[model samples]
Target: PNDALYFGFGKPPILVPKSNAIKRSYSLTWPEEVVGALVFLGSLLAVRGVYALVPFLMALGCAAVTTFLTLKMWRLIRARELSFYRFNLKSAGKLRKAGWAFAIFACCWIGLNAHSGWIRYHEVLGNFAFQKIQVPDELALAQVNPARWLNSTQRENILEGKKHYDAASRVALFVNSEALPKLAWFEYLLGNAEQSIQLLGQAASYQKDESKALSLYYRGAILNRLGRHEEARSSLDQALAERDDLILARQEKGESLWQLGRRDEAVAVWTDAVRRNARLALVNNELAGAARSLGKLEEASAHEKQADQFTPNDPFYQWMLGRRLQALGMSELAEKHLRQAEQLGAGDGMPNER
Candidate 1:
């Protein structure tokens, strides 16, 4: 009879006066619904970017909150029979259901965070791998002194850079746009001007703004040297457009203009170039020669002195000063400078004063 009463399998043996038993319905309250929705939304937002730590932190926070809520739900389940526990079995079931929902949500959140973290880890690893590839120091030294680069027999170092460049190309995440430009310079030192121009163009295509301007500047200078004045001028114009303060491009553009017989335009360009960079010895020398040809002897003398001040040890500058002094009838000073020029290996007669 006790088992029947407890299990509700049959009617009780004794009956007493009945009291009213309140019936209650349990559902999600507004506060609980809002909290659950916020957690779900936050988990989705956490994995939105490339940063790995953000998602990991979000997962940790969610897991902590979910664990706390789950423990509370477990305690409520355990005390369901206690008088102090006002919630019925149906309410306990709802709490358990909510706890499970939070656990599943946390697991999903953690999984997304882990996937993002893995991708970020690979990105970092790829960067480290790229840094580990040894680049030859001579590659940088070569930029300062092409003659020294050409005279160097460090074939192994050059080969190493080439090997690394190839390896970097194979990796999807590696980004070294300057690599081809450096290689182009090496090829230029090797007397491969055509290949250098091609490589520089490739490098420029991969770059933007100032870097692209610099690559174009080099291409223009090389083209100017090769007597391709039109193409050189076009490249230089593009470079100057990209970076108006690129004094080297301005100087090279002037040279290209002079080569194409636009003397007045060339002089105007150099005037602007020198105005921007007064210490530019090459422009000063060019302006000096131009002034002398136009019979502006005083102006020529002034520019020649400026060039001497800027680059006293340059063989070409010594030769230009010697020529200017010779024209001015300062025979002794001209002879001294000419001798110095010869000693310093000014063997190309004159550098066109460009």
Candidate 2:
């Protein structure tokens, strides 16, 4: 698990100007200076525009370039190469002070970008841990302790029950341009449904295609939680219209339909999703309840078996299943999952538990 290679690739190598090179005074022409200024400003703007997509790498590059440029600028100042139109002790003193100020600003800029990149690296790691559940321990236990993977410098959660996602969300706000959708999800995880909705709204202008569909789906799920079934259904419909393969969107749409008194349509949607992905344990659980309500005892038993087979030992997953089942009026099954969630430390404020 040597991460030296990761650091090597993640950060740009430092460049040191050869000290043995002949010192030559290079006078800056007015036109050249103006062009250089334009190029630097343009680079900054370009980096800003694309940083959200490739945050950590862009940040590290900026840090490295800033450091290199500052060193070059300092060397020029020392060599008196930038004194093309300056004279007198007063002007010289002012120039030296300005150089010091610029140097300090560059140092701060480099440090901030490096720090942002480092934090973003942790966010990526946390995501990998959560999304890639192929680890033997996770597979065997059907659970993942995200905090054990993250071990982030910003360890304090904004909320007690929420896990390591808060750190990722916080860092994204600084270095990610396309952070709104992700922030929405994190806020939702932290139980801030209204805040999540607001972020999704803001994300609308920045997202395209699948990202837009994702935001719409998040909005739908949040609306469902807030008991706004009509709005939830509308959002979910839009999401599915854009990307029909979004299984979670289909699942939430089913929730909205069920809440709006369209039980058959909800059942149909759940059935379709289950057909597409049989491993969706929560959907199976939902279908199990729906079948039981319709007096289809054998079908209900089959769906229950599927749920039991696919459901993970993940505390958050169990907690979510419990909440969704409770909403479906499956009190017995809901309480069972909720109790299991509690035993697995879902709301006990111990996110590191296996």
Best candidate, lDDT: 2
| Model 2 / residue 289 / CA error / Å | 0.3
Worst 10 residues of 2 by lDDT: 137-146
After superposition, candidate 2 runs with Cα above 4 Å error = 1-177, 189-191, 339-354
lDDT (10s digit) by residue, model 1, range 1-354: 555645446545354325533456655556656665664554444343333224456655654565445434444555433222443332433544444554466566456545544444444443443344333322222122233332234444444554544543454243446566766765665456787788888888888899899999988877765668899899999899989999989988987787788989989999999999999876787788778778889998898789778877756556655654453334555566678778898776433221
Q: Which ten contiguous residues of candidate 1 have the minimum total lDDT?
A: 136-145
TM-scores for every predicted model: 0.51, 0.56
* Local error of candidate 1 at residue 133 (angstroms): 17
Q: TM-score winner among the candidates?
A: 2
Q: How accurate is candidate 2 locally (lDDT)?
A: 0.65
